[model samples]
Target: MTDDLIGKQIGGYAILGLIGRGGMAAVYRAHQVSMNRSVAVKVLPRQFIDDLTYMQRFNREVQIAAQLEHRSIVPVHDYGESDGQPYIVMRYMAGGSVDDMLNAGPLRLDQIVQICAQIAPALDYAHGKSVLHRDLKPSNILLDDIGDAYLTDFGIARILGEAPGSTITTDGAVGTPSYMSPEQAQGHPLDHRTDIYALGVSLFEMATARRPFEGDTPYGVAVMHVTTPPPSPRLYNESIPVSVEQVILKALNKRREDRYDSAAALAAALRTAVEAPQASPPPDPQPSAPPPIEIQPLAERPIPAPVYPAPSAPSLRQVPPASVPKRKRRPFRLNLWVGAMIGGVLGCALLTVVVGIGLLIVGTSTSEVGPGETPTATADVTPSAHARALVNETAAAVESATPRTPTRRATAITNTPVERSGPSGTVIFFAQRPITVDGAPVEAYNLYSL
Candidate 1:
């Protein structure tokens, strides 16, 4: 991990040479014996190897960082300890860091956009995993031989929901003061936006070739970040568009809340502003109405009455009218009166049968000529013509069966079913002189019947 490890072997990786050394860790180009591929090896400094608390946290954070799999993020190959030192192996990027590029010359606007495009989404992906790259700067963005960029050094990033460890100490400021967010400078609680603010500072530096705020010491610089507003990037680079300047300032806003919510958003804003600097400002919050049309006043131009189309003259049909369908004739049916007559004939036959049956029943009975025998009627029970006619008329009424009106009639003087309670005796009356009943006339009657 130190300078002496140039020719030494640590955990099957042969240290080729030191790549760079930051405050947290030292990166070295190493040869992987098992895979036979060149890889970048990042080792923890010896100063932190003795601190057991930091060692445990470092391993935990690196393990989480290894789980990240993204095209833009530098993929972790392996991580383990050699003796008392922990080291992480990752893809070896050949094309130096943006730090080197900046040191050589000012970056082109398109180059800055291209680099941001690659890293912004990677930062957002880390944030989604609740891992914040507390240290996001030019030095951490690695480029390849072809100028393609990738985000690296994620092993030193702090987990969002966890407490501050030795990697990002809570007692003092966390990241480099040049790119540190205002909240990070003040040692305040941080969220994903802290990384966004640092990105803005980096953007300012890339555009202007200088940090937004500088002081005599790191503490002084951090305080300046907290207290002072960042000078415009255009102040150093007059060629920078105002829209691009606005995006940087917005990301570098003193309040974390005022910054972009996601790294992707910041990159997109920068891309849009830089690409379309001459484009019109965004439309107002309210919906845009159509351009107004001018109309002449009614006083100067009198309203013309609407003219209606003239009606065409009536004309005869071009073709003769289709012939109306003729109504079909129905077959003949029996008249209702004929049905009534047939019904009447049937009813008369039924009545004649009934009358004949009654007469036959009467004729069949023997006349005993006394009460001990039978009702010896002196007259024969013959079906008389008049009686037959009356029965036929009564049978006619059976068709409709309508109720009849009340009529008075004389009661026959024989065989009334009277209730007899006491003694029954015969009473004979001769011309109003024999027996008196009800204190009036003369009549013969059974006493019980009376």
Candidate 2:
């Protein structure tokens, strides 16, 4: 299949080269002409296209993957069949798989936390959407350029709404032995917690650089998953904190009830354990001391009092005469005078303000009526009528004295000429003319404009 697909065009994607090969499918780096970008294309073998079971699983992978939209989940870009073969197009992850990273060496504690934090939420999202990643393992988890983990390859995932025994195979179990939970290994009904167990195994390997259980055969490994209890991660690396070990153990529990209810819950516990401070060792015990003596011998003789010579009197030159402080009579008189002056000034200012206000009112009232116009009101009319008469006279005088210019309708100049000096020459450009008032363009005068 890899040899035939190297130069073949599938759907709208032009196969550029092969990226990796798997048991069921071959991944290739393809150029999507529509998007003008590179993408990873997983092509299933042509033989499986005729098998209803394999076809259904391939379709399920497409449907389930298309629904999951998350930063930590590899996005499905396109899926279709071509030349009697099914293939799925996904984002190309440049950092390879987590399994590849583990092959080199064990991940650091910080790296483990970072990967789990991303993976847990992705599982939670899938579970919330009623999908289960039945075959979760390190290989299924891919990383990006910056080390962000993304869960991929949901080929064997079981939808929660499917009927019972729908996913059971003739051989019974369906997932990888080393990463399968007890329920999964025993062919029992699975749920989101099973994925949590698998994640636990992946995390254990990440922290300890080895799996918790190992066997000579796949069957033996599957059996150990159901029967054997996970060893403490600290056993592999004593530097692992105790809190982290407890978290891993809890996730690896045989019974789903004993484990975290959701992947998010497990992730929270992992983060807390990794970030928590290690417990300090107990202090060494102090030596026991004897009880104090109850009785002590009295002193043989009474202590004598020590005497010292008296201090000599200070000389007359050193002694300052005690003069009575003089009463500050001038300050008291000055404060009274200052207060009186301030009071007078304030009174004068108040009077000036009041006179100014009164003059302003008189001027405004007188100006309301022109000199030639006399406001006369009937005896039955109220003061409001008189004020209305004065307002009418003022408006009439204003209209008569002001010159009436010819009313010109504003015309929208769509292309007004604008000139600016540029490096090449004076650039003449056309723009929409702005609204103007009395031949003056409206200028922005607000604080923001200034």
Q: Candidate 2 on 1-450: residue-level lDDT in tens?
A: 238877879999999887777757788989999999889999988767777777777787887888889888999988888877889999988889988898887899899988999999999999999888888888889988788999999888878877765653323577788899999999887888999999999999998789999989999999999998888788888988878888888889999998889888878887877776454211234576798866544665556699897998877677668999998754212244554564465446534643453454355546676778765422441224434444345434433433323432244544443443322121222233343333433211100000
Model 2 pairs whose backbones collide: none
Best by lDDT: 2
Q: What is the C-alpha lDDT of each candidate?
A: 0.73, 0.74
Number of backbone collisions per candidate: 0, 0
TM-score of 2: 0.59
lDDT of 1 by residue, 208-271 (tens): 8889998899889988998998897888999998888888898888888788899898898889
